[model samples]
Target: MPADPEPTAAAAANAAESDGAFASPTPELWQALGWAPDDNQRAQFLALQQQLREWNGRLNLTRLVEEADFWIAQVVDSLWPLLPLLRERPEAPLRCIDVGTGGGFPGLAVAIALPNARLTLVDSVGRKTQAVQAMAEALGLAERVELRCERVELTGRQKRCRGQFDLALARAVAAAPVVAEYLVPLLASGGEALLYRGQWSDDDQAELDRALALLKARVSRREQRELPAGRGLRTALTLQPVAPCPAQYPRAVGVPAKLPLGA
Candidate 1:
């Protein structure tokens, strides 16, 4: 079980001066997730959060402008979704690729949490990839991560990325239908695609439905929870790719957003 939050004034001030007491969840944020790091791990995580904040200003890597919030929202929040998978497969090392990994939400956090896991952060933009690469290196996580500056769709279509990863992750990167096309080809058979989403509504469900049909995916799970302190609703949709994706997928970049397959 997780312990209570650290009640130091600095902790509170860090949380308060930002947008919320929990703007970004730190080690304190882990309590809400039902887990807590040991003192050593907590300190390491705090230092990493601070480093990310310092670099964020110069590189514009993220909009999580507050230091404390960086610990909570970006790091802890991203870590929450991975716990279930980790618990289920404790012995197996997870091999994951984050598609369109801008500022490394979920990807870097995952790397930090699961040191044993292998992560590949992929993006089409060179500058963004450079930022991720630099941050990972600064955090001393360079050896465990692979930084690839390439278009995910093109990469997926190629013979190489096919069935490469055990898991594929995307956070608010694209619509569910579109993301399915981009993810299916990259996932190994039976690999899972997890999407970090904001708010669950009929429209979102509709979009997911389209993607599931087109890609022959099955909804493995949907973890719904309110963001910390009533910020808003957030959902993590996990889909299992049961079959190979069609060749016409990903629809050239703007195509998916403009005219979604099931739209």
Candidate 2:
């Protein structure tokens, strides 16, 4: 079994004391989630926030640099989708990949929650991946986190990328179908892809349907919640790959987004 995640008391304390878009979740939010970081994990989260701010000035990794915004938009948003997996308490270590990991949002944050879960972060931007690579190294997470500065389409089509993950994650990146094209190729058969979005509409579902038909994946679950600090709405669509993706999928690099399935 993977080792238990220890808490970071000092950082957790600071998290509890602050209030802002970047402030840690309020007491109520904590209660609702029924999960809280231990002393060590809280320290990791603290370190992540600091790195995000420091790198933002140089790499412009994200606009959500303020503490409160960072927590709500990047940290918490990344962790929430893993709630189901955490609840299961699986004994086996997991494999997870984050596509289009701009500055390593859900990928790095999720790594903190599931320390044993191998994390591969894929992004096309060299500087962004460099920033995340440096930040992960600084946090001493280099052992667990893998960085790739490549387009998802190219990575997804590679032999090394196929059927490698228990979970594939993409956030604030693309519409549902487009996300499926980018995510499904990396997931193991029966594994899941979690697509993060701000809103879910009937049209979006319809669009997703067309894409799923092509991907041989299906919507397994959909979750919606108000973000902490009332920043905005958040939607997570969980899709399970029922079959192997067609080889041509993920298409040539830059193709999926431009021609987006179901478009």
Candidate 3:
């Protein structure tokens, strides 16, 4: 009989706490993501997680506090859907903006996995941005990243960031239609936006469908996969802008959250 295959990094990490070495989040998970961090990177990741845990006790930064969840759900899972983009632009210097990056999902993990890419993490809440800044520093990524504490709709007028990013990413921030309105304008022409949706179904496609017609955006790829958490499925809805958004989109503060476009 054929021997069993080696366990994947995710499988190994979730093996069992009793297994010691293979259990919990480890550098091996990063290695599996094709980002075989050196000693420094390994240390940085560990330090960031510890600090996040510390801060979470006070601020409730994230619901994922366990080590295994941090590694698989936050780190490994976030980067999995983004591998296609990284591969296509392996040598290209790209700028990515993660909007409403609460506790920094794809933003922080993407920065760690793709050191060459410049990341701008934006959140309106001061405390969230503060945590993001601290996390970036803890990971020794201060130089490679930028943090913004501002509303997404108000950011369009800023010369430094207006239409500056090559890609935009958001997770569970808002409905796809609203998120498209918020992020598509930030992307350079021909660039793409990635929206993460958890409760995706034939019904959920309504949001994407509405955005495409109204926001001059089109879905390039709809990737669906189960998160390492095993509790829910994630859909990476990739949207490309075919034309500039009407100036009226994104409305004003609290508007997008209250009433998504095409709703």
Among all candidates shown, the one with the greatest lDDT: 2
Error of 3 at 256 (Å): 1.9
User: Model 3, range 88-204, lDDT digits (tens) per residue?
Assistant: 755567899999899987798788767688899999989988988988887888898899999988875566776778889898788778888788878788888898877566556
Q: Residue 70 in candidate 3 has what lDDT?
A: 76
Local distance difference test, each candidate: 0.73, 0.80, 0.74
Highest TM-score against the true fold, candidate: 2
On the 0 to 100 scale, the lDDT of residue 68 in model 1 is 42
lDDT (C-alpha) at residue 166 in model 1: 88
Worst 10 residues of 3 by lDDT: 1-10
User: Which runs in model 1 stand beyond 4 Å of their true positions?
Assistant: 1-27, 38-44
What is the alpha-carbon lDDT for the whole of candidate 1?
0.73
lDDT of 1 by residue, 222-253 (tens): 77664454344567878897677677776686
Better of 2 and 3 by TM-score: 2
Count of clashing residue pairs in every prediction: 7, 13, 0
Residue runs of model 3 more than 4 Å from their true location after superposition = 1-23, 26-40
Cα lDDT tens digits for candidate 2, 34-128: 56776777788888888988999897888886656776777777777778676676334788899989988888888888867889999999999
